[model samples]
Target: MIVAATPADYADRPLYAPIAPMLRRFPDGLPDLATLQRLLEASAPQAVSGGGRPVRFVPPDDALPAYEARIHASGEVPTRAGDWHDFFNALAWCVWPLAKSACNALHVRELAAREAAGLPGRGSRRDALTQFDECGIVVVTTDAEIPALLAAHAWEAVFWQRRAALRETTRFLVFGHGSWDQLRQPFFGLCAKAIHRVVDPAWLRLPAAERQTETDAWLAAQLAATLPTLTPRAFSPLPLLGIPGVTPDSEQADYYRDTRQFRPRRA
Candidate 1:
């Protein structure tokens, strides 16, 4: 049984490192909808959803349209009070507004296409998008070989053999808010769908905030261009625990040998 985490647990884990700055604002508990909206307005005044509506968090409304549609149409994110999932999602909007907006746009576009085509269900593109939204990690690197190793599922080779290089040349940024929620009580088999971006090594040297800004811009452009062609297969699977420093067990080379989490790639 998953015990929902409280604000007190926010700073206790490395998994929350990415969003620590934002999480610090509400140390007592989850922020209410008004607080979230104020944060959005202050932090990302220009932030808007796909349909150009200004992004604002509001209480959940059953009478509204579907979640994505509502966001696209009205930019109102239906946030459940005190819900960790919704809280992190709100943080994602503040941190990666461009990419998040692009994602919302793509979702609206895909849904419209499906309706026009008389499709009965959400198609593969939407499925891929949701998977990424819920559990995606963006692996930014200067080295192409590193992504190749990840794609090959060469856990030992990538996380152990080239560990130093991996640290120097690559950065793993968690993009999925659901993954953030899961990381509150991280488990062995927690894997994330990964998308790779090859960036200049110099870009990696910038401060965290600057790097995130660039990443948001680049990712938004990438998604705007390729979302139509994206499939779940386009992502590489990454065992979060296998990353160096994510867990104490990962310090030793033997940790990568656990096939349960580091399954070998099928031929």
Candidate 2:
């Protein structure tokens, strides 16, 4: 079982250690644009094209128009203005290439579908969903009861009453750029929130520390193993605080209350 390293030990830990296996050939320090591009090419050669042209992730000066065009064209995710944030975002893209692509595709598909059905614009649902897509984690569980609890909005039962089941069956997959960076200095507001998905009948039985490392490693390997073959999931991204008994005025209250997209299972 892996032991939790002290904060002092974290000083020497590699920032990109989570996805090190996928980006196996990068240099030993913080990556520049060239280093990042090489890492991306090494991890997913199909994702990087246009030779020297800035296509996927560009600076905000170019990103504004790119984002606007992408809203219509579903091309690529726009990069933010800052250096560090954009770099983290690029790494997130590398880590969750398929999911990221799926998210972009869904955005385009939903827009077209809505227009064709004579439905109104996305308004706030699309915006909220995009925020979660950009900075959310997906928690997949193998236990049947946990999902039942989640569906019923039985927060106390899932999180507290059956806490062991939650620990034993959960696989937390990080997909957001902000969530990736927050791993360095995690806090309440920027704490890890997840989209719950149920998996097949299999359980993760491991010590806490070992489980954490194994989960990261497993996610990295999964990304490498299933890229072009990945299928879209019916992911419902909600905040940790949104769990029924966790908070009264949850940040995602409106999102959870909305029946159009998220149908809360009332029991």
State which candidate has the highest TM-score.
1
The Cα local distance difference test for each model comes to: 0.86, 0.49
TM-score of every candidate: 0.94, 0.56
Which regions of candidate 1 are displaced past 4 Å?
A: 1-9
**Candidate 2 clashing pairs?**
none
What tens-digit string does per-residue lDDT give for candidate 2 at 1-267? 122232222333333334545433433434556666666666555552212122265434552543533534533445553344566677755665545554555455555566898999674434544665556666667876766676565554565566566656765556666654554554333333355556654335544334444444454454334433432333333444433333344334343554433344444
TM-score of candidate 1 relative to the true fold: 0.94
TM-score of model 2 vs. true structure: 0.56
Top-lDDT structure, candidate number: 1
Give residue 217's lDDT in candidate 1 (0 to 100): 91
Q: Mark the 10 consecutive residues where model 2 has the least summed lDDT.
A: 1-10
Error of 2 at 211 (Å): 14
For every model shown, the clashing-pair count is 0, 0
Steric clash count of candidate 1: 0
